[model samples]
Target: MSRFTIPVCHVDDIDHESSKGFEIGDLNFFAVKRDGIITLFQNNCPHLGVNLEFQQDQFLDADNFYIMCSTHGALFQPEDGKCVYGPCQGQSLISVDFEVIEQQIHIAEAATAIA
Candidate 1:
């Protein structure tokens, strides 16, 4: 299906070594920043389609390494959204396609679908 672009946030707005969640229209997504690289993913955990963060913008594990699911304590690789540990092993968080224009983070989504 066709997609539409929605602005999420500025690249610098995410802060270093942290994540931020956003809810735009009907979409739920989050961004993780580490070493100047930002990764975007859908907020839902694959295990039961639950939001990964225990609280707003707190998706990372205690050590600020992998993305941790608040519901099951699942850990995911930040670079690829791969679930490395916990119940949903081998499953992954859904990655959201995004673009940075003039330092603004923009994600493309469809009017009806998230793609």
Candidate 2:
């Protein structure tokens, strides 16, 4: 399959300890920064398959420690996208392959299949 890079944003544009939303084709995703590392995941919450953000580009909890699901309060580890609490428990967010080049966030081409 042919692959393309979807530029999400500049590294500096994302707050030091927060997340921002992006899209490629019809896929919705988000990028998060924590402890100087950036990670990417599909926006859908594992528990309900709904958007994780309660408000626009707001994925982290008040403390900016974990990704909080808007609907059920699920907390996902920023490093591994694992749900540490809430309804999803052992479940994890779906990670999307991404890379930083020239200080720009670029996601791998959207996959044809979801699962």
Clashing pairs in 1: none
Local error of candidate 2 at residue 70 (angstroms): 1.0
Candidate that would win on TM-score: 1
Candidate 2 residue-wise lDDT, 4-114, digit = tens: 376778998889999998766777888899989999888899888899998899999999999999898999999999999998999999888877777887766644144
**Model 2 ranges off by over 4 Å:** 1-4, 112-115
Give each model a TM-score: 0.91, 0.90
* TM-score for candidate 1: 0.91
**Candidate 1 lDDT trough over 10 residues, lowest sum:** 106-115
User: lDDT scores for all predictions?
Assistant: 0.87, 0.85
Model 2 alpha-carbon miss at residue 43, Å: 0.4
Q: How does residue 6 of candidate 2 score in lDDT? A: 62
